[model samples]
Target: MRLLLVEDNLSLADSLTRALNQCGFAVDCMHNGADADQVLRTEDYALVILDLGLPKLDGLEVLRRLRQRRNKVPVLILTAHGSIDERVKGLDLGADDYLTKPCDLTELEARARALIRRSHGFDSAELTFGPLSYDSVSRVFSLPAGPLSLTPREHAVLEVLLMRGGKAVSKDALSEKIFGLDESSSPDAIEIYVHRLRKKLDGSGVAIVTLRGLGYLLETRDAAA
Candidate 1:
């Protein structure tokens, strides 16, 4: 799934970015709340990880503005302050969950999965589309023919298509959801990744359908004789 991580600590941010990427998530990271707010406003994301102590704008204000705009994207508030009032304030402002500083990465990942599942109304741990299945916890993709190894980018793209199946996701939307501004990656870069992914899934009876000027949709192709 796609995620926005708003944390200011350079070391922590880098480590979290690398870890989340390895877990088959297309993570767009921002070090300031201002940039985080901008991304949240402009793009669609499955979840957001926000730090309370952020530069430019506080995370609470960011959350408030997001709610003010009627954006219901799941948000997990991460803060050094782990008190009753702080938690209450974040929850009142519409954060889905909260994690204190010095938290366990595995635990944080678990919470993220739970929030995502709850948002999608999925009670199970796996995300499935036709014959392809993805284990969000294990970060593995399974298919009937042979399991395909998916990079984070590939996984992210597929997740979007699976979530909004039959809808054409524009290239601009896909790039924003996957690469984000932190990488300085471009739409052309997204095209290249999608091309490679198409090749990998070719002849497998699973199609990433190109919609000409629109973008892409994933669907199952009828079996050939």
Candidate 2:
């Protein structure tokens, strides 16, 4: 497996790199979020171990830009900030997992493996529907050329639809899947995410067709063509 370790601490980076390498991973170590963001655009890695504090940029920004570009590589955040708000913010921005600083190497390795396994899809990695392709490992939905940029909720909505193939998905289902029990969301809010997604995929050779009583279904121009 290939992994990127982005930690400003050279010593910690080296240690993590060595440990991951020993566990049969090809690890690329870098310092600073600027380099991490730059390298991430051109390279594909199974996972990214990102530290929040960096000299050039914050790891959260690196992650935000990553998701904005529609890259779905799983990210495991490493930080000294273990506050509830910080962790929630990272997750909200698309981080797959988080590890507070001064953690155990064994736990980190285990989390890495789990994220990779889920992403690469031990069950199903890549799913295609007409002109769109969803990579389970990277969690990126792509057109022919590259990944599809989407907001966090939009990504979640599309993922549920794609996973269902041609089956109808209700607004209630979308709302439930994207919203947490502790969070507030209305059924109308689900419509907004779907509308935004529909606009983004407008000319992409596929369509999110409304099914009236059923909900919405992703369809190729010619369901029978």
Tell me the whole-model lDDT of each prediction, alpha carbons only. Answer: 0.84, 0.81
Q: Compose the digit string of candidate 1's lDDT tens values, residues 1-225.
A: 778999999899999988987766778889998998998888888899999999999999999999999999999998898999989999999999999999998999899988987787666788777777767777667777877877668877877776674578888888877765557777777787788888888777777888899998888876461
Winning model by lDDT: 1
Candidate 2 wrongly placed segments (more than 4 Å): 123-225
Candidate 1: Cα lDDT at 132: 75
Which residue pairs show backbone clashes in model 2?
Answer: 72-138, 119-137, 120-137
Instruction: Give candidate 1 regions above 4 Å deviation.
Output: none
| TM-score quality measure for candidate 1 | 0.85
RMSD of every candidate to native, in Å, equals 2.5, 14.4
Per-residue error for 188 in candidate 2, Å, reads 54
The clash numbers for all candidates, in the given order, read: 0, 3
